[model samples]
Target chain A: MLSAEEWDILRLSLQVSMVAVLAVAPLAFACAWGLARGRHPLWVLLDGLVHLPLVLPPVVMGWLLLLAFGAQGPVGGWLAEHGISLMFRWTGAALASAVMALPLMVRAMRLSIEAVDPKLEAAARTLGAGPWQTFASISLPLAMPGVLAGMVLGFARSLGEFGATITFVSNIPGETQTLPLAIYAALQVPGQEQVVTRLALLSVALSLLALVASEVLNRRMGRSHVRD
Target chain B: MFEIDVTLRRGERTIALQCASAGGVVALCGRSGAGKTSVLDMVAGLVTPDEGRIVAAGHVLFDSAGGINLAPEQRRCGYVFQDKRLFPHKSVEANLLYGWRLIAPEQRWITPQEVYDLLGLAPLLHRRPVNLSGGEAQRVAIGRALLAGARFLLLDEPLSALDAPRRAEIMGLIERIRDSLGLPMLYVSHQRDEVERLAALVVEMD
Candidate 1:
């Protein structure tokens, strides 16, 4: 039984995680494709950059984002001039979560894209399909199972995002205080053990639900891959 | 029609080739690894030759000297590989129509109904490639290429993957396509009988 304030925290966390996953999915897909198929030296450089967040401490990632996207920072200052600001905002929380989720998403997607037979793409090309059309019709559909798995992993990562979100956007009730932050806040207060337990359970339930749903979706897509 | 003079460097071996054809079934007969498939790839724009000129159906697909190289999609060549290479995810109908919808209506010489009947594809439309037999899958692959408005076709040992009965059946189908459809083909096969039975002109390779 979550209290009204607790419910607000849950809702905000969902909103932020959902926004993060949506915002980052298409970008992550492009990055994955580049890494999987690109033969240029720059692609190797991009591979390292994409994996940086996965290896670096989340706090360092947060600090870098702050330096680049904070109000006084270069991109942030230009954005502020246009009446848009991400510092200390819920959107900033989403950006933090998205950055944290990227490497996991891209890694999953790239493996699947690489597994696609290039000969099939060649066949499509001879059948009057252009590069983009071939990717959409053949490569993308063949990679759906892995792409869905990546989204699930990304969503779970975004939902649990803490260090980066806390650093980029300070915990503010109903704004940036997601599940982990709310639990931390409750733990700091005396006699608030029950509140912490409830929030923690909710987080576990959400992650479990994502895992089960992704399993079901993957089975359906896997039928096509049974022979291959 | 095809006129090709190409040179390719493959590891230590250098493949130098020259051929001219007025079109129909021009069989490229060679032993395994003789670069028969590589020639088809060059014409399809999948593999670039070191220096070459390829003219197919009166269109110059590649001419290194003139800097004229068209992309695979622009060449309008139907390529049926040894493996058939049917899209695993799509149903037979979808796979059949995948390229058909890309061609403009006025340029579309073959209709879906005609292809379905020609290839006996109607019965397999609802099934995916994974469920299809080798012969059925090969038929769908050919139907797909035809529906794409291909000006010419390249068949790379198209019957090499089938059993004896299936081979005979598909060979018959190929004869019908050649005699009825009147489409020009650059057919590749190592089998002497297949070449003798299907090709009007046979070019030997080492």
Candidate 2:
């Protein structure tokens, strides 16, 4: 029951959030693993930086992203020299969403990694595994449930990301207008309440589906871990 | 042959131990907090000693004065933890083969079939660690260690967690492994009977 424009918004939202979660997963895993296991002195600082987006106003984060990744910004200028741009682009929206979702990803993953017994890792070491080998064989597999949960959480957060995305990419109808932005746009126009309702319902449905999927995945992983 | 002379300090506790083993099981008997496990951990390179030297299998595993400390994986010492510490995500067979896979082909003398037969693990090969009994888990842990090409084994109270019957069963299994493989072992325990039954050399600690 959605029009072509509404369909485009839904499709773009899905694409942007997917990209955001995918891009954030690996980095989040590395950070979580380090925070959970490493004894580096700078871990406190690193942790603070990772969680900054979670506590900061979304608009502030978006502004920081713009400053760092806008065309006139240092990093953005370097990227632009290589034929890349994030300013007011869908990629910029994805970047903002990813940033907003990262803390959840890292927190979930870190807790999971921490739950894995270090004694088991030591046991692996004594059984001929080096650091990397032990992590690959033991730590990573045991922490998989958390990593999956983190990804779903990140995806959900990305789906609802509005302030950072709007501030960074603005509201471009077919390019950067995600579901939330679309709903917001529909609200600004009087007598477009029907459009707003449909979009809002779609967002709720998408988020609920994600939460259900995460629960199913976590249960399956938990069962396998228990059986093993 | 194995030799260790180490001093470790953890908080206010200081554990200083000196012992040497020519062959057979060398039991480190001590009360809790007496550094029995700490000694084993030091030899396995899991815990670094403030000042010590550890030599095993004609190689210097650690020498604090000489600035030489081999990593745990480089020591070729199979350590069986008290809790078994079997990989929960892996099946019994996979856990048994965990260390064997890392050894160089020529160094891998213990075959999977031999391990399965020795530990009576064949029946439980496909089962996970969570499904196994305490005794079963320890047996798999032992098999995993032995197959890793360990020149010697460091067993930290491998039988402490089991009941009397299971303890006896594992003790019997340990006796068999000693007889069959003849690998030197450092067995940590506080039990007098275990020391009397299995150890050829006893290193008593306070």
Candidate 3:
């Protein structure tokens, strides 16, 4: 029931969101683990920085990202010299969305990591597992439910990201125009109300599906964790 | 011979313990909060003594004066906690093999099959720790430690969490393991009967 252009936008949205979630998951997990376990005094500062994106206005966050990652920016210039340019590209949209989704991912993962019993880690160490090995074998697997939930939340947030994506990478049709951008573009023109309505419905359905999937996965993990 | 003379100060209380064992089960028996667990933990390298020395199986595990403190993994002391603490996400086989895989093949004294047979764990190999009963879980924990090439085993009231029958069963199994493996062990318990039955040396603490 949709035109080829609409399909392109939808597909691009999925691609960008998936890439965003995948790209940021490892970094988010590391930050979460550090916040949950590390006793360093700097953890308070790190925690605030990680959650800044969640509280800041999306436009402000987008502007900050542009300042740090724009072609003229220091990091961006160095990366450009290496032939990797994120400016005004789909990769730029992914970067913005990844930043936006990072706080949600880290929060979910931190709570899960904290739930894992430290005594279990101690037992693993007694059994000859080193610190990294214990984390890989015990902490990571036990916190898998949280990790999965975080990933789903990140994916959903990335899918719905509009303000940051728009500011960082303008809504160029077939390039940066994702689901939310297309919906916004459709709203600006008269008699495109129907397009907007369909896209809105699709977004709600996708978000709902992600929430339901996360819930089901979390429940299963909880049951498996309950002792015999 | 195994020797431990450690001093740990926690707030207003200071626990000083000195004990030695000559190649058999040695029991640290005392009331709760008498630092029995602390002594075991210090030997396992989980808790560092403020000032003391610990020697087990000819290895100087800890010497505060000499500044030699080995990490828990490097200490090679298999600790069976009171709650078993078997990895919840891992299967029985994986839990048993968790440490076995880390040790060099030449250092491995006990094989996986030996552990499985010793603990009667053949049927529960594929089941997760969540699916195991308390007694079964303890057996798996013991089996896991044995396979890790433990030079010495530390059982920290491993049977306290079980029922009377299960406790007796595990006690008998512990005696069997001690006899068969000939590994020196430091058993921490408050139960008089448990110490009387299994320990060759009983170090009573207040």
Candidate 4:
């Protein structure tokens, strides 16, 4: 028998994760494109910074986020003044997840973009496409497989984001307790073992599902690029 | 109308090109890396030369002396790459319509239906580039450039990537594009046959 609280946590987790993924998509695409195409010294530094969160301890990342966006720090201070809050909220969890997923997204997109022929881009230009038009039309779509893979991987990463989310947003039940946080909360209590197990199972299942979907999508995209 | 006289000093390799034109295909014949495409790059505002004056259709496209270089999209010339660089995300229809969107709507002299007819692209209109064949892709590419309101056309080894039969097919498509569009053209090819088949004027590179 599932408790109402457990179900509420589960539902909230899904909502927050999906919103997080949706919000991060555009940012990820831009970062990936810059890393793949933009040629400036600063681009390299920024690329490294985006990938930094992937290497840093999630707890440390959360601490940094807490400082910068905690309704008191610069970003957070500005957000609070603007009547938007992220600290210890579900949105904060999403941001944390987004930061964690950024590197993977950038990596996948870069690979796909690199695989494309530079000559093709030159061709697009000669066809009278402005730079932005060329990017929107040629670069983005051809990098679709990578984009899809990036999204799936990001979603999966966000689904299990534990330390950074917990540290940055805190595990406020119903408001910010994502699946991993909820599971962590459940595990701390003696009688909530069953709930923890269920959520854990759900996480594994979702990750597997995402991987399968990416494989299928990539294969299909490959085929379309090949034959009748 | 296009005219170019340029000397590109690349580290040590000097790419030299000389040609001038008003309204006909100017064939640039040379071995690979003989600076044929490099010349087109300068005329289309893709590359800046060390010393050059380039004029296209009475416009100052590029001139090292004047320090003037127009951007590619602003030049209004059509360029067909060897690989047929169609937008992968768009349908054949959308890719063809891309350049069409850039020009003033009223200034457009080419129609999608006409392009479809010219390239035999009707059956493939809804399809993405990933589904196109070698010959079909090149034809669509040619049609796309023509419909994009190009006053000048550049074909850079337009048939180099295909098999002999596919190459022959694409060559004919190139001819059709040139004949129908009536735009001034600069065609780059090493194959003398290709030069003879499509060019009305020849500029041989050493």
Candidate 5:
């Protein structure tokens, strides 16, 4: 019952959220690890900075991104010299989504990682595991369920991201107009209630799917150890 | 061989210990909170001593004045913790081989099969750490340590958490390991009879 334009919106939204979650997962995990384990006073600052997106107005986050990643901005200028740019592009939309999702992902992952017994890491060390090895073999696997949950939360947040994305990338149909932006655009017109309803329903469906998928993965992760 | 002269400062307490041994099982006998586990931690390089010299397995594991302190991974010390810190996510077989597989072939002195046989761990191999009984978990913990190509062993009250029968079983296994492998061990325990039965030299710590 959806038009080709609506189909394009759905596809673009999925692509943006997927890219955002994948790109943010590793860096978010690192931030989570630092917040969980680092004792240095500087970690307090890092923790605040990482969670800044969660507390700040999304429009403000979008504005900050625009300043730092706009073509005239320093990083953007350097990237432009390298034949790359994120200004008003779908990649820019993904960047906005990623920034908005980071804090939620980090918070969930951090709690999981902190819950991991430090004694186990010490044991790994005595068994000849270096810090990196201990993290990979022990810490990461133990924290997998929460990490997965974080990713799902990030994906959901990215899918729903609107204010930052619209501010950073603008509503360019077929380029940067994702599901939320599309719904917002539809809401601006009279007799577009049909379009808004369909889009909103699709958003809820996608979120539910993500939650169910995470729950299934979580159960499987927990069962993997008790295979006997 | 082990030679340790270390001073550590805990909150509101200072622990000073000096001990030397020509190998075999050198037991550190002390009551709870007497810094026995801390001493083991220092030797394993898990904790740094405020000031000390530690020589283990012919290596200067730590020397404060000489400015030498090995990392835990480099110490080649098989530390069996009292809680039996097996990776709960891994099978017993995987836990046993976790360190064994990391060592270079040339550095490895024992085989996984031998560790399994010595500890009677073959049957428990497929089980996870959560499924193992107290004694069985301790055995797997010991086997895991032994398979890591340890230059020496550090056991911190490995028997304290088990029931009487399980404790006796593990005691027998410890004796077997001591006699057969002849690896140097820094065994920590507060029980006098256990120390007397297993230790070649008893160093009392307060």
Candidate 6:
């Protein structure tokens, strides 16, 4: 019962969010680890910078991304030489969404890491584990629930992100137009109330699905960690 | 043998300690925060002092004058936290094996079977940390360190979290490990009874 454009928006939403989560997962883990455990003077400064996107206007964020990653921008120009174009493309949408979702991901991971006792790490080190091995074998597995919760929360947030993605990548149908943009376009067309209604229902369903998935995954992970 | 000489100035209280252990349990005895944990932390390379020298079995883990400050892992000091600090997600067996994976086969001393026998972990091998009792968890913590190829074990209030009966059970196990392996240990606790029962030598702190 859905039109091709509607399907295109749904597919694009999935693609954009998946790419965003995958690309930033390792980086997010590193950032969260540094924030939770680092004891240097600049730790607070780094923490503040990581959370900047959460407080800034999404539109403003999109604009900054455009200025920095657009073809004319210095980094973008350098990247273009390597054939990596993130402007007005799917990658651009992912970048904007990842930037928007970073704060939420970091928050979830930080709490989990802080909850882990330092003594345990000392125990591992005594057993001859290097820092990286300790993290990989001990900390990461223990923090799986929080990491799952963060990734799901970020996916849900990206499904609703309007300002940043729109500003950074613009609303190009079948290219960057996600669920929110599609709904916006439907509302602008007069006598097209039916399309608007359909899109709204779809958005609610998608968001609800993400939320439900998160709860399920977190619960399952929590069960495994607690027993052992 | 392990030898440490250091002075720690915490606020106004300046605590200086000098001690050496040679393959026997040495207890750091005092009430809470009697510099008991600080001493062990320094020896384990967890904390740095203004000026100090820690030589454990000929390896200088920390020497302020020599510009040598080895990390906890490099120092080969096995630490057992108060709460056990088991990897919550892994099974008891996996948690035990976590440190083993990082160790070369030649360096690994404690076998899984030895751990299983030491703490009766065979029954709870597949269980998670949440499923473990207080006594069982501490026993796992002990086994985990042993399996990781620890040259020296640093136990910080290892049995304080348990009830009376559970503490007794774990203490018997500790005695057995001490008698069998003769491994050097720095036992930290405020309980005078625990210190007297387990340690061969006692260092009283203010």
Q: What does DockQ come to for candidate 4? A: 0.50
Choose 1 or 4, whichever is better by lDDT: 1
lDDT of 1 by residue, B13-44 (tens): 88777989887899999898999999999999
DockQ winner, 1 or 3: 3
Ten consecutive residues with minimal summed lDDT in candidate 3 chain B? B82-91
Candidate 5 regions exceeding 4 Å error are: A215-228
TM-score for chain A in each prediction: 0.95, 0.94, 0.97, 0.92, 0.93, 0.92
Please, what are the lDDT tens digits per residue for candidate 2 over residues A27-132?
9999998899889889988999999999999999989888988888999999999999998889999999999999999998898888888888888888889999
Per-residue lDDT of model 1, residues A96-130, tens digit only: 99999999999988977887889999999998889
Residue by residue across B22-122, what tens digits does model 6's lDDT show? 75788888878678888887887777877888887668888889999998877767778776778776678888887777778897877889879878999
For residues A1-228, what per-residue lDDT tens digits would candidate 6 score against the true structure?
788878888899989998998888778878998999899979899899899999999999999998889899987999999999998898899999999999988888777777676666666776777888777766777677778888888888888888999999999999999988888887888997888888889889988998998788667665654533
Question: Chain B, candidate 4: TM?
Answer: 0.92
Residue range A33-146, candidate 4, lDDT tens digits: 888879988998988898998899999999999999987799999999889999878889989988888888778767777766566667677767788877777777777887
Provide fnat values for all models in the order shown. 0.82, 0.82, 0.84, 0.63, 0.75, 0.89
TM-score of 1: 0.96
Tell me how candidate 4 scores on lDDT: 0.80
Question: How far out, in Å, is residue B56 in model 6?
Answer: 3.2
* Candidate that scores best on lDDT: 5
Backbone clash tally (model 4): 0
Q: What is the C-alpha RMSD of each candidate to the true structure, in Å?
A: 1.6, 1.7, 1.5, 3.0, 2.1, 2.8
The reply for model 3, stretches above 4 Å from the true place, is none
lDDT of 5 by residue, A4-50 (tens): 98999999999999999999999999999999989999999999999
lDDT (10s digit) by residue, model 2, range B1-206? 87889999888889999888888999999888898988989999888999989998788999998999999999989898887788888888888888899989988878889988888988899987998988988898899898999898889899887899998889998899889998889999997677787889998999
Docking quality of model 1: it rates as medium
Each model's lDDT comes to 0.89, 0.89, 0.89, 0.80, 0.90, 0.83
- C-alpha positional error of residue A1 in candidate 4 after TM-score superposition, expressed in Å: 5.5
Where's the lowest-lDDT run of ten residues in candidate 5 chain A?
A: A219-228
